[model samples]
Target: MKILLIDNASLTPVNSALCCEPKTGEFAKELQALGNEVTMYGQIVESENIHAFNIQENGINVVGHHRRKLKIFNYILLYLLIIPQIFKSDFIYIFYPSAFKYISILCFIFNKPYGLYVRGEMGLKNGVSSFIYKKAYKVFTVTDYFTTLINSLSKSNIAETIRPMINLNEKDIMPVNKKNISGIFKVLFLARLEEDKGVKEILYAIYKLKKMDYNLKLILVGDGGYKKEAMHIIDKLDISDFVELKGAIYDIDKVKNMYLDSNVYILPTYHEGFPRTLYEAMIFGTPIITTFVGGIPYLMRDKFNCVQIKVKSVESIVNALIYSINNHEKMLDYAKNAQTTVKPIINSTRLSHAEALHNAIHNI
Candidate 1:
């Protein structure tokens, strides 16, 4: 089977492999591993169009266009370049909702069978989106919460749940013994520094914690558009001394070490379709302090594997942190339960995606 995979997020061509967002590039390779000819199309966020032409990166044929200052022109050229591949593909798998709005119409016009892989919260935008979703051959969403959202939009319950992002193997990773680091508590926030991701709330919570003289430090990871807002909040709150923004760490081992070293992993996200961070935190046996949003509630229980807090509630976040800090032994129990429970549940991986695509193609 020939597959045309499209995603909205850009990937940088570093050396011979595409750098950043390992999920998208890795999924393409997995599809190719399934014996399907795959052509992936995405934008490059870099300033220079280094690999403008179609190039083979990491054994998969990837065509990544560097978007110049004129964004519309980049999309136009991308559309023109991938049109032939879209026409030839046996099946199309769409990732990241932004592309679904425009690409689905082309699939419909060509009478091509395509599937939409919805990973997070998104709106229908317009009726055309609803129409395209309703007519889709298959719809794959990250969680049941997102499935319900998509079903409501399409006015049909055709969407199915699949966890195609299990990146941790228990045998390979040695869970961090946070007990080794005593006295000072370390909280890790590994996500885009976007405000909607509860960045502001977390910062405020940290400010309040520092005011109470709780010996602590926050390691903020990842880079995003809300970086300025986050810095502003940190500046205003006067919590700069307690917080450190590590930007984007591409090294997987370094990220794992952070998770292992930290006492708690916190991601008070507003919207999600089952973030891989939760699993990574669990696998590393890091106590989790996250909000009850999106597919998160479905994955974890309050006081079970994580301390669930209300979104945008600084008090709740602070209280959750206090609870983790005061009740250290219980927190370790939660981490242990999380580590054991999460391992059995996250059975889906890149291979699961390949099997699904293969089945979807064969069934058609």
Candidate 2:
């Protein structure tokens, strides 16, 4: 089987150095290991009409177009260049549904069937993405909410909810002996720094916790356009020392260690499909305090696996933080339950995505 992996999700500006999507590369590599020939459509910052070998070292062929400052003529030229590659493959698997809005039309013209994976929200700019979903062979979304939304919009029964398979290694997992979360508590927030992500609310929550005389350090990771705004909040609240904005740590090992080093993880996001960060934090046995939004409730229980906070509520965040701190033993229990809940689903290497892809392709 020849598989064409389309990773159209743009990386945050902070992740510019890394050329390949980690999950897509891992998924494609797994497919290739299963004896399928896989080719990736990479997202590179290029100036001219060009193609670069992105993951050739990993045994996957890549052909990509320049993403930054791309004009209408550039897209036209890129479409022409990529059309032949689409013709060469037996199946097309797209990472982002909106990306297929235009490419799916080309696939339709060439009589090629493609499967779309919805990571988060859709591009409903012209209401044509619904039409694209309708034409797709399969629609795989990370959350049940997305599956239902796509099925309703496309009027197609092909939508399936496949869990986001996190790629964790033996080295990435902290040993049981080293997994103690006692002493000066360190809270970690790993997500894109944006208004909707609830970064400002998190900062205020940290301030409240500090005022309560809790010895804790809040670390904010990842980057976006809202960095300055978030920084302003931290400075204005006079809790700069309590919060550390690490920006985006591109090093994979560093990210894994960041989770391991922290005692708690929080994502007060206004919206999310299924946060991969929570999954990682759970796998690392870090207690999570997140808002009840999207598919998060499907995985995290109110007091079973995590502390459920209300979306866009600073008071809720502060209360959850206090509760977690006060009930340290129960917090650890929730963290343990979280790790147990996620262990069965995470595939690390040969992800469940492989099985999902296989089923989607053969079931047709």
Candidate 3:
């Protein structure tokens, strides 16, 4: 099968770590390994239109387009450039939202089959997404909630849930040190420092914990538009000493090291489809404390694989942290269980990738 992957809107050059790119790249690699031809087209936002090669280092071809802006005229230009390439493929797989309604209509005008991967929260925006959902042949979402939402909106029975997959390996798995425990437990919050991510709530929880004389270290990773506001909250609460914002962590190895070093991971995100960070933390054997929002409950169980907290409650988080610290053995067990749960799902191997793709293809 010849597959063409389209990532037109989200192919921002600002994505240095290529957080979103890896999954699509992995899919392309898997398809190529199965003796299929795969090509990925990424659109980069730029000042002037320029063609560039984003080398597919792992058995796929990646083409990039640099456009001045995402205005209507540029979008039209992008559509014109990408439509022909998309038509050339046997199958088309679109990631995120695409100008695909226009391109897909063209493809349909020529009788083509295309698939869409909705990795973001659906139904948040109005008419635009509803139209795309209706037109797609196969719609893949990261969570069941989103799948149901898309199904309801589109009135299409073709929606399926495919959780985000990561490259996990035996080498990546460190020795499970049950005996080793942190004297001052390090709690990590690895997400964008934004209001929607609940960073303020995390800081407040830490502050409350400190008021109760709990000695804990909180590390906040990732940079976002809300850095100043989060910092102000930290200052207002006078908990700067307890909390440290480490900014955007680009290196995967460095991120893995953070996971391995920390005793517990907390993500109090207000909304998420299925966060990759949660899986990343779980795979590294760190106990997770995340809110019961979106598809989080699908992966984590209260007191089993992870501790699920309620949204926007500082007391709840502090209580969970205290409980996790007191029941060290239970926390370790939960961490181990988390690792076990995710290992089989996201192991990084050609065989596993082939199997996942085969299942998806067969089901679709």
For each candidate, what TM-score against the reference? 0.84, 0.79, 0.74
Candidate 2 yields a Cα-based lDDT of: 0.75
Model 1 regions lying over 4 Å from their true place: 13-20, 47-55, 66-82, 124-130, 148-158, 170-181, 232-236, 348-351
What is the model-wide C-alpha lDDT for candidate 3? 0.72
lDDT of 1 by residue, 1-364 (tens): 7788887667666665555366666677777777888877777675222222223646776666677677777777777777787888888888747753578778888888888887766663457667877889888877777777678988887787765465556564455445654667899999877778999899999999999999999999888878888888889998889999898775678988898889899988887778888888887788898987767888798888889898889999999999988888888888888877776556533346656666667666
Question: Number of clashes in model 2?
Answer: 0
Residue-level error in angstroms, candidate 3, position 224? 3.9
By lDDT, who's the top model here? Answer: 1
Per-residue CA lDDT of candidate 3, range 6-103, in tens? 76344435334221345555666777877778777755543211112233445576566666554787767777787777767777777655454456
For residues 1-364, write the lDDT of model 2, one tens digit per residue: 8888777654222223334546666787888877788887744553211122236667777776566465666667767777888989898887764443588788888989988877766463236778778888988888777788788888778888876756663335443213454677788999878899998888988898889888888999887768888888888999988988887775667887898888778999987779889878877778889997877887789899999999889999999988877787788788888877776566454337777787668643
Model 1 clashing residue pairs (backbone):
none
lDDT of 1 at 123: 61
Q: What is the C-alpha RMSD of each candidate to the true structure, in Å?
A: 3.8, 4.8, 5.2
Global lDDT of model 1: 0.77
> Residue 80 of candidate 1: its Cα lDDT?
74
